[model samples]
Target: MSKRIWKYAFSSALVLITLSGCIEEKNLRPFILPELVNTPNYLVESFPGDSVLLIAAEGGILTRYADDRQYAFTVSNYPVLDQIDPTDVEVLYSGANETFWLRSDSLIITFSRERISNYRDTTAFYRPTRFYFDYCLSDDGVLHRIDYYNEIWDPQSGSFLSDYFLAIHRFEPSGSGLWESVETELSVRSDLLSSPNAVFKGDELLILTNPSYHVSSFRSGEVVAEEIPRESTFDQVVDPVWNTDDVIYGLPSEPAFFSPFDAIIELPLVAENSQRLRLESACSPSADVIGPVKVLKWTDQEAVVYVQYFTNQLTTANEVVGYIYTYGLKDGSCDINSVQSDPILLPFSNAIRDVALLNTELYIGTESGLLVYDFATLTMVPYLKNLFDEETR
Candidate 1:
């Protein structure tokens, strides 16, 4: 063959091998079944129907009014800050003295005793766009590098978790912060879900079956899971700064989870014959799953649950919710109705609402006021404002 013909033949052979390899890699994972956890109301979840009121704390005892009729703080006290659309705030980490950082959309704000700062486009990696927390909990004690345009989760070690990452559940930094980590995952009959929500106990991990909203603890050297009534999967659990407590949880998918038509025919995480709890709410018709359930805090007895609502059907062009709900152990649930309703009143995007609990306070990261919780209380300091201002300058 001529030189050109020889080259052509080699290219054709390479193409065949590449195409064949692509077909073989379609499924790199093998099939496995979801391990059934026999518990009551363990898997199925519920969310609140209406919006909740979240007050914007502007240092000391000063708080601003709601931007709109909504309850959460939509605008900040700082004149130079951009308004945050109300989303549930996530990861409230206290900073040096009166400073703290709010992670939203890959941007980390350093709210000092002053205002909001402008931010570059960035985000937390593991946290998807609609996912509430894209930021990890951090403080001055730890040094975090800017990785993946500020999107990647920087292991406290400042590098990737390689070789045996799957076997390693706890990512601890010796001198990072006064905080650590907790990981929890939802599995249905053996299939591993997206995020693993773990509750950090000083020397223990209170693992919820995701089977029964009930919880049980596991220490570093203990087995992977302990028993919790052979049932009881928590709807959501959040671990705050305190070294010894875990906020436990339970849930009801609210207006949507109770849908008379497509309601979960079989509760996702409970006994085969468990009865479903029909809840009350005022969500618009055709809302999909009530919302993704997560922990604002968890303890053996008392626990706080955070639920975000998406009321449109699967057919809606783009359905999103700016509402959050909190539920507890007793006979009452608090609805913090601090959210912005006017679509065009803030930044131009489908509303993305998120929340985080720091110390004894709650901060809502939205399209309006970046941090609405009161700082100076030594809990969560506002970083979004600082970040916003830094960039703006």
Candidate 2:
């Protein structure tokens, strides 16, 4: 369908869906976590080929859900609190056999086969480098991290007190279940704004820089940056997802108001043609914001894009609430207004920090806990409750 026609169709469907009370109501339940205190962020990851999920919440809380059994690791049982507090978890990611969580101070926690190990790579976790902006894990389990740093110059001493750096570091696992810096994969000593987004297509690492409109690829100790064609300039690119193909789906810094709708951009890392896909909010008339795009799996014809939507936009104060939608994808593009499906509302009290999908259910991690939303029945449930009483392992 054409873009305009698709928008109008979605508008009509949205009106009907809204009027029919299709959007599920908020029925949030409490998570049974004992030591989850003063935490407002949570990240989630799903184990491949199994019905298992791992949730990492702020305040140094980690929980796993396998079928009907829920297991948690907190300060009481997990003695690693001396190394880092429960509130230190800033990012949570999963690899084939291991799950990694980054602390606020750059301390990393690696979980494998029910064992937890903590390590800090001083080479990459140097001073003045506060946090990791974006990252991706390769098939071989190496983590490529993009971080920003700045320094001040002192002219009287004829030396630089501080300087700015945009670096990409590779962290590989060691024999002791810890991680060490393999190398400083790519570091640029420039003042240009860097996008915290990176993806791996086979062996090449693709990265982006804002305003500069350049996508850099790193491989075999060589870094080559190609400027995105001017016709497809973006203010910002966040939450990039890469499939087997060369194209990546990323959310622009902000959603377009109305005209010339810009929701998701199809960046051709190596291809010549660039395409921008349209995703308008049917629930909100004022704004059409899309949070992040994650490709659960890709097939020969289509891929399932799990996206978070920020609806009910207002000028003075936005609602800060939204639902989950599955945009249709084919031929390396998305059909936001696909006739095959309608937008499903999975409301959470807080903004979505991270999401993981298992089968027909979505594991949504928020500040409170993990929400399990069933796509088949359009219902939601909260997990990680009563955590402190018992510690698993």
Candidate 3:
């Protein structure tokens, strides 16, 4: 009860606090988002009502779908390239409105025009790459692929480059704006690889290869020139949807690629040969390989992401659960728990070939029919049901 006793008690408390700091606690962080409009448990809102016209992909039309027995709406608005056999045609996605791209099976054209939704302007054009053109994002969408254009300043070689730029491939709304080459047939496979959810950060376009992290650049399609270790900390780069540019490529000072997994990859309007800057990442994945995450629409405020969780319920026979999270580049914070549950359960996640977000509305293009959900109501309605019976969704 004297001074000596008081001193000893204070010392003991300090030691106890220090020891407690050394013990790691289990992480129980719940789903968080930036003012999520709907609960994560199910569809919360932002869906078309039943009275609204339904869209289906029964015959590969994106905007318009065949009704019970016949095609409905003004015209079929699906992606025509998706219907064409890839072996017979070459498809290239430009970074613009919902991945506007170009397609042609004829070498006589030898060029790609912007094609997506109702955006058809044969006059304006961009290069293409190996990309899946849904209504979301693309990796390295705005990245330019420089070939000749000899007048431009030489980068590594320091010469006025003479080769023609094969194509300037852009990924998201404002993604990496890097450089690629369509000079060779293997260029797409050799450079960008695959993975709809892949991300591009700095000079690294982290992609999902067969069994490795295929790291390239949206800038110079070449590696960083360092001895890229055969091994990478990332297991796989996947779910490579691209964000959209607010006003297409003509807009100045936009991002090249904004990915949930990779963050910002390339800065807009940078010199093609600019030294690669060591950009930072906050949501670096830790899995040996993580991919096929859900990609939402592109917004300047923040990027949204979702990871997959499998279930065994009859409804989830081969189900996939999507965990929604938002990453804010402007504020450098992530709302990992924007949902009631981290992984929102879905019975047949893979049943749908792809997903696109129109506002808060979630559209799933599946084998059977296109499913639209009203998040506010937590209700989902199947479109083109009878059509699915006749053909695939």
**Top candidate (TM-score):** 2
**Model 1 accuracy (lDDT, Cα):** 0.31
Q: How far is candidate 1 from the true structure (C-alpha RMSD, Å)?
A: 26.1
What's the residue-level lDDT of 83 in candidate 3?
44
Tens digits of lDDT, candidate 2, 37-147: 224435565643445565655555554544444545665667664456444444445545546555546566666554677766555343555643666676565667766
Give the RMSD in angstroms, all C-alphas superposed, for model 2: 20.4
Candidate 1 per-residue lDDT, tens place, 1-393, comes to 599998999999999998888654354443211111111111111111111122232221112212212211123344322332213222232333333344334344444333444343332333321332223233332212211111223367555431111111232324543223333332222222212333333333333223322223322433354334433333332222222222233333322222322111112223313222222232232254444344455333333433455433231322233333343233333443223332332233222244545443445443343333332332223334433344456
Please tell me which predicted candidate would have the highest lDDT against the true structure: 2
Point out the worst 10-residue segment of candidate 1 by lDDT: 33-42
Please provide, for model 3 over 216-267, each residue's C-alpha lDDT reduced to its tens digit, 9 standing for 90 to 100.
4334433332222333222222223223431111111111111123333322
Q: What C-alpha lDDT do the candidate models reach, one value each?
A: 0.31, 0.51, 0.33
Estimate the overall C-alpha local distance difference test score of candidate 2: 0.51
